[model samples]
Target: MNLNQLKLFYLAVKHQSLSHAAQELNITQPAVTKGIQRLQEYYEVPLVHKSGKNMELTRAGDNLFKIAKKIFELDKLADDCMAEFHNKGLKHIKMNASESFGAYYLPEFINRFNLKAPKVQVTLEVLSNRQVVENSINLKNDIGFVSFPVKDRKLNSIEIIKDEIVIILNPFHSLAKKKYLKASDLEGQMIIMHEQGSYFQKMIHDLLEANNVCVTMPITFSNNEAIKKAVEGGTGIAPISKKVAAKEIESGKLVALSLLSTPLYRTFYMIYHREKHISGPLKQFINLIQQ
Candidate 1:
């Protein structure tokens, strides 16, 4: 039988009388009887009968009543879950981002979000910019954050934030004394870089190559934290987002130098599947970052 009929049948069984069931359901007794009849017809079994002026359930009716009770219980649970998501708050969110943004900036956004929704669960995956784009295009994540603008049309992207890439140097280095650094000044100087495949490394190389500035890179690390530590230890210098090295720069543990040739600025983008529906929590997160 259909769900409407099943609900009527359930109400009839709960009240134990067609007249009482109809009164409670705000329907005519004949309507209740018709609904029960439809259920019995579909199941090909007698659901109830009168015994000495009292309604009693038949053997098949007892089983059906039990099943109907479970169905309504589950339906109530589903309603409660959806109500919480729609009205009170969201329960979960999945996010993906590149290493620099995820490590340096996303945590602040998450902290702000937690202030608004303390109980909501949020998980973030730190990957490469290319990986972030792929995950967004594949709908594997609810939101993607990347350091560079994503050019793919399959994914909708918007610039969320902007950060400057500054030349990080040891305070003891000679170039650190200069207010402005020329491309030729960095020539032949030791440069600590991120892993070879990193977009930041590629940008640094491209900018330097275009300026005819070549530097030696003897150390490469997979993460910004390690590279920052390497630069602090006077191993070499690197060009990284100022946001990533903000603490070090503020603490005087790292020195930031501006390039005289061309300013290095990176714009981070938020991406998602063009057709994917953004949930409440995801939308709140986007707003938090944008703010």
Candidate 2:
């Protein structure tokens, strides 16, 4: 059961010479013999016999040698894998983020990171703000981005960006020409809402309620893309991050109207578990994004 003795026996069987095995092991020939002797004693079998200046393995020794070959090969493979990781030859990063950051912001950072570390594989999942925080706290991901600050002892967060919530309307909508709009401007208008209970939905809801603005909520979508599409199709006006609709605004497919009475903004934060190990590739990615 002693690994050292098994190794000695394996090496002796491999070279068919105790002297050669000892030379490779950097030990005395007598030491190699004693090691093999201990193995044979423990197994209660004659593993090897001298035959005309060469060593031959018995049937039991042949079977043990096969298993030893596999064991040593696996050990070597494990060493090689660890060495590659230490050298940063192969790396993977898993991340979770809210839809706004994941869909609109993080792609640029990921592209830049890939240019720097082409070998590192990156995976990103889009979830709600609460889901991002929960995943980060549970160590389900290496990093996370959320729309709001997270206050958890198990997590470390940094405010990465501040995003403004803007009203997105169809370019042909009557209010699209207005430079800005007041809460009353949206009264009785069909409002495209995010999924119920979402942070974004709550933010828009609170803003409207605070100003006593009553708008008809006719449609709800779980993701920004769907909401934007609905707005472009003239389904209703939607309140969303300006950055999320930047392309549509630039293309004149959608017009963004600022809130004249109460401006709304949300902070995006990069979060990770305090106990998570920041590997070389992961640190590089964090630096690239933060920069």
Candidate 3:
């Protein structure tokens, strides 16, 4: 009828006597008899023969005992599996990030996380700033990284890191020699940019307008790699976060210029849905980037 009763049925069938089963199972003989009676009543069958001192099983009891043995074995296996699932730790983590950090920053951090949790599986998605916001709102990813401010009041966002947006130019460009260029000094120079709706795009547009500097119509690209390539071709100059251009700037291909009279810094955020429950794996990942 129930697991406890089934267990009693199994023990009674094993020992072949209610008194002996009661001794082995730490229950009274009446309790064992009651359990067997309940099971017999539920199935409407006789489970024992009254021919001997040690009872022998009926045909129905043989089949029922076999199943009870299997259930007990399965209970043991279930315990083992749960123990391993907990002891071995989380199996996987799904993470998302915007352009700047996704390409440059996340790989090394994820590698280090794998080292710490070797058994855990991990999938990383590189998304735009908009995608990060939308994914977090929709609870599509366990964690998301974004550069700009997110207005979703229903999400939890942590500004884990911050860095400045620097002017980028090719090595052969005239302005490449300057360590810093003020907004006023940028007048009339060709400038490629990330498309509108990007955090840096809005910031640069506002900064140039406030300082009364305007560049000629120039190429614009939606993503960073294309914009970087366009700048490297001497078509125009664009500003980007220094973290994203570390490799190119280290090499001789491109140069980074600081902005004068401007504090053009963007904060890298770790955002997730507030309603989504934080599992140990997600918490571990947040801890990894937070440090």
Candidate 4:
């Protein structure tokens, strides 16, 4: 049977009603039934069984239905792959970035890139910073915008801009109104922290060593949003990037302070594989970042 018949069989199993499936396909019920019949004949299996105005798949039919669903999805997958293949020559760029970059930077940056290379198709993938790094050097993604430096030898990095990590505290906390505080001043303070291994975590690790002060971990979280929420609830304090605190600071949900002795700061870096050839779209994007 043809792909159309296969599609009908898949839809029939999904909806469990031949008439409903036919309605969705905008074809007659008999046409849909005929398609399923043709499919079962070709595949030598009954892919659906009806009872009490509803339908269910027999054991063998259930497996066949699952396979049929994947087959249809594969066709769509092929379409996307082919589109990428053709579009690459016409200046297509695929990028994977952290949520902050995708949410804050991509809209205007992509608009500018499109103006520079009108024919390019720019696809942006929003993921965690770690995922961006993984996709980048693994070659699944064309370019990666990461918040920290990566140590991979195959990865090339360009320092984009440095974002200061500010010491944040609850508004009513003793240190909240301070103009500046030193690293030693934070001792014994309830400092909430994100989990380890991230660049920000590494920065904190270095900061403590540089200041020769170590504060006990007050609370820990796995995500930036959770850390911010804990801080907002007056659970504890945290040192975080300016970009992460901008909205909260503006809305008066938190207070930002600088360290007098050990000022916290982190740099954002644009990274890509050194050996990977830059596509025209990615080249334009890199130029846009430089500008």
Candidate 2 Cα deviation (angstroms), residue 114: 1.1
For each of the candidates, the C-alpha root-mean-square deviation to the true structure, in angstroms, is 16.3, 16.0, 18.5, 9.2
Q: Rate the local accuracy (lDDT) of all candidates.
A: 0.84, 0.87, 0.81, 0.79
Ranking by lDDT: 2, 1, 3, 4
Instruction: Tell me the tens digit of each residue's lDDT in model 4 across 157-232.
Output: 8987677788887788888878988888887777888776666777887888777877878577877788888888
Error of 2 at 7 (Å): 33
**Runs in model 4 with CA error above 4 Å?**
1-91, 99-108, 114-119
lDDT of 1 at 22: 88
Model 4: which residue pairs collide?
none
TM-score of each: 0.68, 0.69, 0.68, 0.64
Residue-level lDDT tens digits of model 1 in 1-291 = 599899898887777777888888799999998998989999999988877656688999889888897687557545534655575644777799999889888898898899998988999999888888887775677789998777887678889888888899999998898998888888999998888876678888898899888778888998989989988998988888888899999999999998877888888889987666666677788788777
Report the number of backbone clashes for model 2: 0
Off by over 4 Å in 3: 1-90
Candidate 2 lDDT by residue in tens digits, 245-270: 99999999999999988998978999
Error of 3 at 140 (Å): 1.0
Q: Candidate 1, clashing residue pairs?
A: none
